[model samples]
Target chain A: DTAVSQTPKYLVTQMGNDKSIKCEQNLGHDTMYWYKQDSKKFLKIMFSYNNKELIINETVPNRFSPKSPDKAHLNLHINSLELGDSAVYFCASSQDTDGGTEAFFGQGTRLTVV
Target chain B: SQELEQSPQSLIVQEGKNLTINCTSSKTLYGLYWYKQKYGEGLIFLMMLQKGGEEKSHEKITAKLDEKKQQSSLHITASQPSHAGIYLCGADSSNAGKSTFGDGTTLTVKP
Candidate 1:
């Protein structure tokens, strides 16, 4: 079974089009996250949700919004996508323990805004 | 605000050779993780180190967290083409369940 899965492994859309990427995890994790990997392979955290509650919000543009319908699903919606928003988006989930946390990542959705 | 910096952005090694990739952090690391990603794929968790001076080995890959907990290294022995991939280092300073990742080091093993 795939631990973490995301829809639309590849997305190519118009510059002004709005798009959404859906993610789900079956690991029964309490925390989930959205990360963006730019062309330089810099993976930066954009948002984090713990049990459907927003916990961490990086300084991402307002056009990007994350919605967690439940603990198992977290989706990202981008409005009026710009060229700068073209990057690979990854969804990850982790369970926190006193010892440490190990994250499981989805296959990633490659978004290209032209 | 780059918190983690991985050295040797990319490397090329011959089969049966050994190589090492280093990750340096500007602040203390409460937990450090090593992950590998193939082209256009998700990250695969390799190992996690919390205690300073900790070392873990998996197959021919070994990861070590320095005594200061501010640096870590991933070493591969008897490199093979199948081992080529991007290795990323993630650090959590507060153990807040969120991690800060480095740009990643790309390794290419040639036959």
Candidate 2:
């Protein structure tokens, strides 16, 4: 079984359009995270949810919002996407909030805003 | 906040050759992880090191954490074209499962 999976593996939208990426993990983890990898290949944390509760929220734009319906699903919604929003988005899950535990990542979703 | 810096932004090695990639952190690390990412794909966890001076090996890849827990190195022996990918190092200083990742080191293995 795929441990973690993200839908719409590839997204190409025009500027000002809104889109959402869905992530689901069957690892039965409590902590989940959303990360953005820019063109430079710099992976930056965007948000984290533990058991459906927001734990970490980076300085991302207001247009970007993360909704965790439950511990197994975390979705990212971006409004009025800009060119800068073109990047690969990854969803990850861990057993707990302990850094000692290894994280399982999904096959990232590549977003392109033109 | 913590920052990870990786040296030799890119590397190219011939098949069967050996190479090493280094990751340095700004603060002491509580957990260090090594991951590999093929183009347009997610990261695959390779190994994790916690204790200072800790070392772990998987197949031909070995990773080590420095005594100070502020740096780590990943060495690959007998490289193969299949081993080519982007290697990333992530550091966790807060033990919160939130990792700070380095830019990444792109490796290209030639036959």
Candidate 3:
């Protein structure tokens, strides 16, 4: 069984379009996060939710929003997709408690904006 | 800002050789985690170090946390092509559940 899964694995959209990537974790983890990996391989956190509560919101743009309907699902929605937003997006989950924060990442969604 | 810097951005080694990668944190770390990511895939958790002077090994990979807890190292023994991937080090600076990841070290093992 997949511990953490995100879809669609690849995304190609045009500028000014809106898109959403869905993520789910079956590990029963309490914390879920969205990360963006640029071409330089820099993985930066964009948002984090714990038990459906927003915990950490990094310096991501307002056009990007993350929603967690429950503890097992966290989805990322991007509006007015720009070419600069072309990068791989990853979803991750963890236990949230101190010393239990080992994250399990999803197989990333490669977003291409044209 | 909290940052984790990994040295030797990329390395290539023979199948039987050994190599080491280092991660330095700009701020004190509450915990350090090591992960490996294959090309076009998600990251796989390797190990987590919480205390200073802690060392753990799994298979041919060993990770150590420095005495000051600001530095960490990952060493691989008898490298194999199967070990070729990107190794990343993540640090939790505040113990608040947010981890900052390094840029990652790309390793290529030749058969």
Candidate 4:
């Protein structure tokens, strides 16, 4: 069984459009995160939610929003998408352990904004 | 602190060779995680180290964390064509709540 999964593996949209990507994790994890991988392949954390509560919010723009209705689901929505927003978005979950932790990643969602 | 700095941004090796990738940090690494990713696919977690002077291995890959907690290394033995992909090192500093990630080391193993 897939532990983590993302929807709309690929998305093509125009500027000023709004779109949403859904993610779910079945690992029974307490924390979930959203990361953006740019053309340079740098994985940067955007937001994180734990137990249905927002725990970490990186230096992302206000147009980008993350929502988690339950512990197992976290979704990302972009408003007025821009070309620079074209990149792969990944969803991950982790079980915290001894001042450290490891994340389980989902197959990324490649967003292409024109 | 930039957190984790992975070296050699990319690597190319012929099959059956041994390779090593380095990850240095500004803050002491409370936790170190290694992951491998194929193009356009989700990353697969390779291993994790929380305590200093720890060593873990899976199959032909082994990872080590120094006692200083500021450095870690991933080594691949007898590399194979299937080992081609991007390798990333993630660190959890004492700050917690989030993990800092490296840009990644792209490995290209040619047969």
Please write out the lDDT profile of model 3 over residues B1-111, one tens digit for every residue: 539999889999999999999999978899999999998899999999999999999999999999999999999999999999999999888757778899999999999
Candidate 1 vs. truth: CA RMSD?
Answer: 1.1
Deviation in angstroms for A92 in model 1? 0.2
What TM-score does candidate 2 reach? 0.98
TM-score (0 to 1) of chain B, per candidate?
0.97, 0.95, 0.97, 0.97
Q: Each predicted model: what fraction of the native A–B Cα contacts (within 8 Å) does it retain?
A: 0.72, 0.86, 0.68, 0.79
Of all native A–B interface contacts, model 4 reproduces a fraction of 0.79
lDDT of 1 by residue, A12-47 (tens): 999999999999999999889999999999999999
Using all chains and alpha carbons, the TM-scores for the candidates as numbered come to 0.98, 0.98, 0.97, 0.97
Ranking by TM-score: 2, 1, 3, 4
Name the lDDT value of residue B55 in candidate 3: 100
Predicted candidate 2 versus true structure: per-residue lDDT over B1-111, tens digit per residue: 439999879999999999999999879998999999999788999999999999999999999999999999999999999999999999888647678899999999999
Name the docking class for model 3.
medium
Model 4 compared with the native: what TM-score? 0.97
Error of 3 at A47 (Å): 0.5
Top candidate, metric DockQ: 2
Query: Runs in model 4 with CA error above 4 Å?
Result: A97-99
**DockQ of every candidate structure:** 0.69, 0.83, 0.70, 0.71
lDDT of 2: 0.94
Runs in model 2 with CA error above 4 Å? Answer: none
Estimate the lDDT of model 1.
0.94
